[model samples]
Target: MIGDRLKMLRKEKGLTMKEIGEIIGVSDAAWTKYEKNRAEPSIESLIKIADYFQVSLDFLLGRTNIREPQFVEEANIQSEFLKEFEWSKIGDPSQMYFLVENLSTSIRKYNEHKVTELELQLLLKTISDVVLYFNTLAELKEKYKSITKEVLTEHRKTLSQIIEDLNNILEEAYKDILDGKK
Candidate 1:
């Protein structure tokens, strides 16, 4: 997926592999490997590639179809959170977009070198897992809607703890990345 997008972007820019290699300080052969999907760029290189192509990591990896590097689509996050909500209409799009825009912008800033590459990847994975968990929880809730109140409350508590744990992980990472407090 990344190789395909990289190839397309290179072609669109009329850049030869050798040229891009020079621009990125890699061998032409290495660029070929990336385009062929035979190898992956290190995160730093991936960030450069994403920057050069004016796209997102999510887009290069085909995690999303939107090609422009905008705020990670709130629709993606909202849909994941509400996919199984029988009462999906209860979701407010404006609120969801506001949340996602801030989260995604922080990530984009991280990618721009506000944080180290490893930390940026950590942020990406953390947020991706969060979205995944939200989607899965929605499914589980929809599936077991008939459960008793006690069971539902237990589920809510368990999920709350999981979310708290996830947030803690992210918060610590931010401290290390932004505050240099590892």
Candidate 2:
């Protein structure tokens, strides 16, 4: 599967086996062997090939039809979490796609605006925090499915604290922007 996919991607890109070998830090003979499925690539080489092809390992391995790699801190845990939850039932799945698109747009705008290093750093940190906040919520949901009143209260408190911290960061960021404009 990996070999076939690799060959297809290379052909699609109009690259020769030698070019791909150079790009992936492998010899041309090794590349040919990979294409023929005569030799298997090491995990590191597989990752390099996947990165070069901008494909998911699962897709390359034929384990999944999905091409995009999932971004997660813990793939095994998240896969289990995903199996138990239907996120689309809670909200439109398309909204998540838009959320990612919006983040990319936001970063592009920030770059275009040529924001100061401090502001860019703060924005990046806040983005990281937002991801962490959601992960925390998911973890909470996964950990305590029973959701007793006490547990619910604790979860609310935790979420509220995180929100407050995020708000503080945003306020400081806004203040910096306003000060810069003044």
Candidate 3:
């Protein structure tokens, strides 16, 4: 999947393998191997490739067909009301993106016979729970407008702690999933 995307992107730019290799500081043969799926680039190299192409890591990894990052889309909002809203803070898009990548990895493992159906289901459930909790926290903050200032402040503090806890849970889950894969 990655190899195909790399080849396509390289061709789209009218770049030869050697040219791209020089740009990425890798040998032409190594670049060819990546395109052929015979070798995978290190995470550092992957970042370099994505950066050089001006594409998102998700797109380079074949996790999304969309070339633009979600944040880019968010930044293009034209409404003044929406522009004032810090949507990214309410639901940390970076965390969501990381979760998406983990889910994609789990699905791919399941498809490749690397993980059991039950494992995949558990991962899906964990992800669903995290999203539900995170969104609920966001909703509570926005929906409690009539509450006393003191109460609202306390709620906000509590909500922030809960969000942090949820984030820790997600990070641990992601580590567990990747560790299990290894």
Candidate 4:
């Protein structure tokens, strides 16, 4: 399963197994073993392979077909809102189809934004930072699922605050526009 998926992804990306092996600092024979299911790489090596292929470890291990988990589902909804706003900006009836085609390309990208290790690390670090910042919040500690949950919850709260602030700013800007205040 792993080998077949890797081959399919490599072919889809117009890459050869040798090229992938070289990128991950493995010999062609070793790569062949991996591709043929004769050998399995270590966790670290598997991570490297997944990174080189721009896929996820779950995919490399045959645990999942998806390259990335749903980290950007909310972002996708936001993109839809932006696309609608873009359509409203383009008033010409003849331009509507063209705008839709352009929007489709953008939506495809938005939906395919895979969460890489670097992104995951950054997210974890941000969460850690938040937890460190609010270490004294005793009640918050009990609400957490784990020590990591404290961090994650803090991160989520911070993000929610930022989003709320942004919405407030946008509302104020819209009010100004309505009042002809530029």
User: lDDT values of the candidates?
Assistant: 0.76, 0.74, 0.75, 0.65
Q: Superposing every Cα of model 2 onto the true structure, what RMSD results?
A: 8.2
- Judging by TM-score, tell me the better candidate of 2 and 3: 2
Report the number of backbone clashes for model 3.
0
Q: What is the lDDT of residue 74 in candidate 3?
A: 42
lDDT of 2 at 172: 60
Pick by lDDT: which candidate is best?
1
Query: What's model 4's TM-score?
Result: 0.39
lDDT of 1 by residue, 1-182 (tens): 88998899899999999999988778999999999999999898988888878888888888987777665566565567745443566656566657767867877777687755565555566667667766766776777786667556766776676576667656756775767765
Q: Write the per-residue lDDT of candidate 3 for residues 1-182, one digit (tens) a residue.
A: 99999999999999999999999989999999999999999899998998898888888888677787664454344234343444646665555556556766877888998766665665566556656666765776687665567556666765676566556546555676768864
RMSD for each of the candidates: 11.8, 8.2, 14.9, 15.7
Error (Å) of candidate 2 at residue 30 is 0.8
Residue 96 in model 1: lDDT? 65
By lDDT, rank the candidates, best first: 1, 3, 2, 4
Kindly report which residue stretches of model 4 are placed more than 4 angstroms away from their true locations once superposed: 69-182
lDDT of 2: 0.74
Compared with the true structure, what per-residue lDDT tens digits does model 2 show for residues 125-177? 66676677677667777887876675677668766766766676576668757
Q: Predict model 4's lDDT versus the native.
A: 0.65
